[model samples]
Target: MSNRVLMKGNEIIGEAAIRAGCKLFFGYPITPSTEIIEYLAKNLPKAGGTVLQAEDEIGAINMCYGAACTGTRVMTASSSPGISLKQEGISYCAAAELPVVLVNVNRTGPGLGGLGPTQSDYFQSTKGGGHGDYRLIVLAPSKAQELYDFTLEAFDLAEKYRNPVLILTDGFLGQMMEPVELKEKPTSPEVDKSWVVDGARGREKRIIASYSLTNEIGEANNLRWEAKFNGIKEKEQRWEEFYADDAEYLLVSYGTTGRISKSVVLNARKKGIKLGLIRPITLWPFPEKAFIPYKNKIKGIVTVELNTGQMIEDVKLAMDCCVPIYLYRRQGGMLPTETEILEFLEKQFKLSTEEV
Candidate 1:
């Protein structure tokens, strides 16, 4: 097959999952993200994979969890409301240490939102959306190409950590069409499946569940998982930076907003206002180190988001400073244009707004 093709973002993500050796997929149909399930249903079977249109979001996620427990690569995708419905299943996957790929094409709001792109789910996906002290590896892709590339990366990260991984995309990326360079079919690794359930045919039986009767045992399990997360945080942080080495002002963002912020940085630089951008590819083990070198040099920082100010808090926490952090956001499916973002930056940094 050719390496490059023009396709919808959601469809490309489905193809990327298949190429990543994902053989089992379970998802409920949801707007803006339905194309992914639709594509997988039509194509996965031909690739020797199974696609099940589960009864609901919960059923789909649980099915994914089961497949992951058997050491089979599995995936599920949904929009904002549907993802909320799958939260309990997601937490179960975390507790059971199942490696599953969960994708969320976010739309608007707290409930029954419209099919417009939004990043309001930032807090939900990154900061222990489900109950218990758990974390999911989160990836935010800005373009259709990253959407395709990140889907493949998500499976690898999931198995590497033996935990659920999330591709926190938005409706704009899901619905937009672009040319993407498809990855070559991945070669499966020599993975050890001895830990998986194989019906106890001669070997000892394997047990997997998230329940514990006593507090001591539960605390032990939690501590073990916490150690794994700390290791992951040390090894798996990924991000992108432009003009940050010497900038006086910095902009932090992810997903579509990050892409827009890049352009804003270029324009601001042309106007003689030294600006830089930090786009986090991994949201959970956030690219905290990306800010360390610039922490002392930057005069101020701005966070641009599709939501009001969810990610700004993380920026503050990561930088751990009181250096005049500001937020420019648009919610309820609205995206910030270059002019709006630049104007906000100029106003916050006290720069002249004219022609900048």
Candidate 2:
């Protein structure tokens, strides 16, 4: 027996947040991600939780910052444009070392692109969305099941690291519906609350600020944050490999695009193409080690992305561009179908064959 149900990706995120012990949610509605706010508004109160529809994305994130600093589990969600507006607040949360969860249901965009699914936010998310020497724990879930499971884990990771955690999904996964098992809500890891601002009733006054006027103090704070990031990089890299055991070519992708590329790998294998897929679950840590083993073994690597080639830069850094590395991309919310991806791979194969 299981508590399985069919749910849209965005709605599942809402439900998972509640089950993850999130007590407060503040967000401004945006395409593809609006369902999360709507679902939470309707359901969270039933479970003694609170949801607020803020005036704007900026307002919503500042609200999140306030709630999180009080030691309450809090989250906020938005799309690319809205996420841009929230960066300043996100930086504040990071500098203050507040544990918060931010969900971005990415849509195509440089500015006001359609509501179509896109992964163009990779740079914004993984490279520290705000201005600072900080990093976020980014989780990319391709399916509804991973959306639910990762949301459950995100809260704990945020608390454990005392940093903001981001659940990065795109319009495709945000709108699609699938059957998923709703597991029992896991308890968040217990952390010291002595630093929280709760009126300072019985202890010394506590302050949470992202400002360090003096150069010496600023350097010290940044050094400590860098140490934490190094620890996370070592321990939190996560990824999935399919058909890579004897693969001669590797395709790197993440989120919904990763699943599509997996299908391409399967079809290519049937035609004796020897293609493999490496789907990253954690984007910030970037799963650099995942490429190390295949570096010498593979003849070439191709990175297929929803954006022009955001993650490919990280791929190049990971593999040092050892073998021939190619980029196959479609932007502005266009998805790359299996046939198109296969054709691209075939073109590369033909070129290699000619060279040989």
Candidate 3:
């Protein structure tokens, strides 16, 4: 508690990684996320950790894959375009069942868009941007503190599930400075490393590969991966609710958008509007269970985002289309103001803005 300090979200992630026993960082510097590598480069060595700036995102992620096989915690950070470059390596890590932490501080992007903040990478982060039936445990952090806490949690989740875990943030959250409490060191517990390919000096050699030469082996691998994914889905769904117990209209968002929507919910309530919010912290598992309590209560749901519409699909599926869902988005790094969001809700729900 005495360790509280004002810090950028990206730097907080680097600090959290250091405390979590992550000794290796391999990444190329990219805006919105470069601070992560920079912070780690300066501080990680002090913690007896090593930081390497790879020639490219491809090299960086492959480095992560290699380190993960050694049964050690390693991480990489990049923004949208860099993250896209690392997808194949990410898929390889997933297929190899490696435990690695990845950070995507998203910026505007179709391809090299700009340094402006945006949630455009939501699809890529949550929908298996790489190839061939794989899932990354994606966690969305809405604030600077969450960026710190979730980084610690991501390392643990990646190792526990033996898969890649992604901390999906954006340029805004990554660069934003806020006061955050630095939680105590070493939040991770020891895990079994008998599966690692570390050493075979006195025992049988261990091989870690993703290749499947036969259809039978390929299908079996896919089936096993699917079972593991199902287990994650069943156990890891997490969310945060705001004034949602008996609301009629719901706002669903994550990351930066979730932060803004929190205020919109409060303002709407003050004006006597029945508004609530559900912020999904885990994007992969989708937190469908969070909608269960609101299913019979809410009239409609609106998904607010920095992109056109990606998370709305998950929201619709979560409710099974039993409730009317709408979208309010700002593209090309634009952020929707709380007033704009409230206006949209007022019009959509035909609710009064009169103060109670």
Task: Give the per-residue lDDT of model 3 (tens digit) for 206-310.
Answer: 999999899999999999999999999999999999988878899999999999999999998888888899999999989999997777777999999988899
Sort all candidates by TM-score, best to worst: 3, 2, 1
Q: Output the worst ten-in-a-row residue range by lDDT, candidate 1.
A: 185-194
Model 3 gets an lDDT of: 0.92
Work out candidate 3's RMSD over C-alphas: 1.2
Task: Answer with 1 or 2, whichever has the higher lDDT.
Answer: 2
Local accuracy by lDDT, each model: 0.91, 0.92, 0.92
**Higher-scoring candidate on TM-score, 1 or 3:** 3
Q: Is candidate 1 or candidate 3 better by lDDT?
A: 3
Q: Which pairs clash (backbone N, Cα, C closer than 3 Å) in model 1?
A: none
Clashes of each: 0, 0, 0
The total number of steric clashes, by the backbone 3 Å criterion, in model 3 comes to 0
TM-score of 3: 0.98
Each prediction's TM-score versus the true structure: 0.97, 0.97, 0.98
Over 4 Å off, model 1: 185-189, 353-356
